[model samples]
Target: MVGAIILWIIMIAFLFFILHAVIQSALDSSNMAKNIQDIRDYLYDTKREGRTDKRAVAEQLLSTQPGAPQDLYEECPACGEKIIQHEPECPSCGLRLKD
Candidate 1:
């Protein structure tokens, strides 16, 4: 019968619609996972690159960018590390200092 044939066509169309929606949902999930993975990789690379030569790559910036005696500190003779006037020895190089 024509009615039965039409009913079958509608059922097949509905199944195709469901299949298309499932495939689209899967693709969206995959894309979101890929985006998260890329962000994790970037952070990991930054940490790895900063693992070595931390001292050499560093600068001892003063809190007030010292120009006066109040904020000034002693400098290390061996490694040029700044020593607070109150500190008896150089913290960075562990060298003894004269008061």
Candidate 2:
């Protein structure tokens, strides 16, 4: 009788553990889906607003903290597009700027 009770306890514990894992996995999936949807919404809004430049989108979404060093930008001679300094090639015209 004691052995039968122990077996039932172990089986219940195992089932509980599986249930907990499945619940946790489901919650994680839901959270990930929500995050993806949020990103899609943001991208749709950005496109609707006519802000198509990669640099412009990045600058708008990311800001340097106060007292932080700022990144330098210079105009590309080939296409006149403003590009980050020290970049090897112009993103707009694909001109090689340095070795």
Candidate 3:
């Protein structure tokens, strides 16, 4: 009887873990979908606005941080290249980095 109870407890614990993992994965997927939708909307808006310099807009959206110096330069961790503020693509390795 004790062995069966132990087995049942283990099964329940396993199921709880599985459910938690599944729920976490679903939440992550939902968040990713929302981010993609946001990017799509931003692109559509940019196109509608007739902005010729979409790269500038994209760079602004991707890199602009409050209270940050505009001309400040940082060394890239990947290629050790000096990168300026508001730049996303690394000049050396073309790595998409968060500025």
Q: Each prediction's Cα lDDT score?
A: 0.65, 0.77, 0.75
**lDDT tens digits, residue span 1-99, model 1:** 999999999999999999999998897689667665655675566468875433322222223233434655667889988767656677687887765
Clash pairs, model 1 backbone: none
The ten-residue window of minimal lDDT in model 3 covers 61-70
* TM-score of decoy 3: 0.35
For candidate 3, write residues 1-99 as lDDT tens digits: 999999999999999999999998897689666676777787788889998774466566555444545556677779998777557878789988875
| Angstrom error at residue 62, model 2 | 2.1
What are the TM-scores, per candidate, against the unseen true structure? Answer: 0.33, 0.35, 0.35
Instruction: Name the lDDT of candidate 3.
Output: 0.75
| Candidates sorted on lDDT, descending | 2, 3, 1
Candidate 1, lDDT over the whole model? 0.65
Total clashes in model 3, counting residue pairs 3 or more apart in sequence or in different chains: 0
Q: Which candidate wins on lDDT?
A: 2
Question: Sorted on TM-score, highest at the top, how do the candidates line up?
Answer: 3, 2, 1
